[model samples]
Target: MFSFCWPALLFLPLAAFPQNAAPDAAGGHSFSNPATAICAAWAGPATDGEKMRRFLEALTLDAYVSARHGGTGFNWRDITSLLARVERICTAEPARSLAEVWQERKTAWHRGSWKANTVRCREILAAGDCNEDAFFFGIWLYAYDQAKDGRSEATLQTLPQGGGAMVWEECERTPDARLLDVLRRMQGK
Candidate 1:
């Protein structure tokens, strides 16, 4: 009954949303070929005009993680966000390979350059649907907290339960609080 979708698909109409333009569902990271865009089918005056096609052959060749009906249970938003970034980069530098640009800006263009802030998290909770964005944000929070505490990785023991319910309960308790603050409190940090 539910479907997986990003916040108004920030990727498709990426130009419309510039950096620091209101907190929306956002995250960024890198993987696969080093090029900014692993496989860019550039076709016209505008890099994103019609006829541009991205085939799965490249994806299948260098597939990282796959998405399932229940979602990948990973910080996929960051990865997806990174691809979106690479796309933008590739558009500007069409001559570069997806891997080439990706390697160049992997660290510089890491996640948080365009992250989904706490306000957006609250809005996602208010909507009453634990979509991928909401769910991944929760996982993102848990992992983020783990990293902040100097933990090498987020283990099952430390990961909070209740998924979207947990986020909803926490966000509702502190309507104006930042998502990281809530996460810290939940983890007793």
Candidate 2:
């Protein structure tokens, strides 16, 4: 005995409905501020790989989502390139912060001027390296068919078992493929 009016749900505002909220990442750290003094720590030796990866993923993910929701007018195509450019900026001026460099690039570069790097496969998939969390974070980014309000989330319970291994196997065969494309195909999109 179950009954409900499907038409009633359509009138509800997106905010009014419950969403599959993600738990606050990184000890409730608010990475909303771009000038949060991250380049120094990121460039320095990483003592705790997990924490470092979490923070990095969170920061970049925030930026990506912000751009997605019109926070930034032009969204950067992918995390790998965005991070690569951020790394370049960090290397050139260790004192400058992420948001500063991000803003600079926003003004300087065209939206589609650049392409995602293929060699990034090796870097993104290499776990236990200094930049270990990129793979999981990257997966989370593409986990949804549409990244909005966490409606279609890709969680551990939702993903098929051995999915990660399948990605690794595919990546091993095609080292030059786009990470997002690879992930999408593996997800059977």
Candidate 3:
């Protein structure tokens, strides 16, 4: 004779599973677009340290790709430095949302004047033996920095051809393969 309670059998599988599984089953969180994912993670509830670190690393890669697409021939040192700075800032202000902290940083820099920043960007471009790539990279970085500084969203809106805006718009529109690569490498997958 076999006696099985159907309700108990049904409940068995559910009980074996974690009651509070992470929102994202594949990972703690997942998104088709890495940039959007990073931004969302930043704005979302508190996450584990490892996850946060991975997000920062991905953000660094995204920024690097964005700059390169704009034609900046930045050295590894520069990229690493930027990553470290951003990580430090974000780490220190864990309570603040990423958007809020980013806005605050932008405001701090914008107070210095967008015109001056733009001029400085040009000077940096001119000082170097800039080729077409370098020139575009400079423009992209300038626009991105200005946008971050809260100078004007229009800078992002109307950037000239081969500028940061172009790359940014593309990133926003679709998932960047390079970004996925970076994430995969970070995850050791």
Candidate 4:
């Protein structure tokens, strides 16, 4: 018979590894919320904070599209709240500041000031030096220009929703099996 418990000893440590993983570290894990848990697992060091920020950007744009074209099915209040949730999960200083600015823009939009939204987006773009920030600015600019030409309504209705649903789906589509597995596990739980 076996004289040693080597197999059991080896398995014990491996089982403990998951629980011991760090948060925000390289290859670390986080679970800000169930929804964000999926993002955290799906968002590894490579994607981490920045990609998550982009996902928020997508959600913001989706809300705008829904509000403008979904026959008012969406609300700016909901969009601002969603952005705030994303900002909290992202936990990056820049994201926090962006969230505040976004909230202000949402307030302005509610007050019927589209120019305020445009200005806020421009300010965010100016403060950052990356595609993610630029993307939101571009999206807002596209909306602004289209609104000016009275074509945004048609575009908004045609656009698909991009909040939680879109981000999670895209995360699942990522090539990394580990990230995919983590997201799957979170979704199942």
Q: Which wins on lDDT, candidate 1 or candidate 4?
A: 1
Alpha-carbon local distance difference test for all models: 0.39, 0.41, 0.33, 0.34
Model 1 RMSD in angstroms: 14.0
Ranking by lDDT: 2, 1, 4, 3
Q: Candidate 4 on 1-189: residue-level lDDT in tens?
A: 012121122222222212221365576453222112323332323244344334434333433433443211223335445554545544433223332333333432433222223233233223333333233333343333344334433222222333223323333454332322322343352
Instruction: Name the runs in model 2 displaced over 4 angstroms.
Output: 1-67, 70-120, 125-133, 143-157
Off by over 4 Å in 3: 1-25, 28-97, 105-125, 130-142, 145-189
**Residue 77 alpha-carbon offset, candidate 1, angstroms:** 5.2
78-136 per-residue lDDT for model 1 (tens digits)? 45544566667765765555544444444422333213233344565664553654544
lDDT of 1: 0.39
Stretches of candidate 4 off by over 4 Å are 1-105, 108-129, 154-189
The candidate with the higher TM-score, 1 or 4, is 1
Q: What is the lDDT of residue 153 in candidate 2?
A: 27
The Cα error of candidate 2 at residue 177, in Å, is 0.3
Candidate that beats the other on lDDT, 3 or 4, i.e. the better one = 4
Instruction: State every prediction's TM-score relative to the real structure.
Output: 0.41, 0.36, 0.27, 0.23
Q: Please, what are the lDDT tens digits per residue for candidate 2 over residues 1-189?
A: 112121222222323211323224442222322325334323432344334343344334444444344432222334445555666666667555555555555432223322222234554445322232443334344432233334332122234445555656676787677665776677666
Lowest-sum lDDT 10-residue window in model 1 = 61-70
Estimate the lDDT of model 3: 0.33
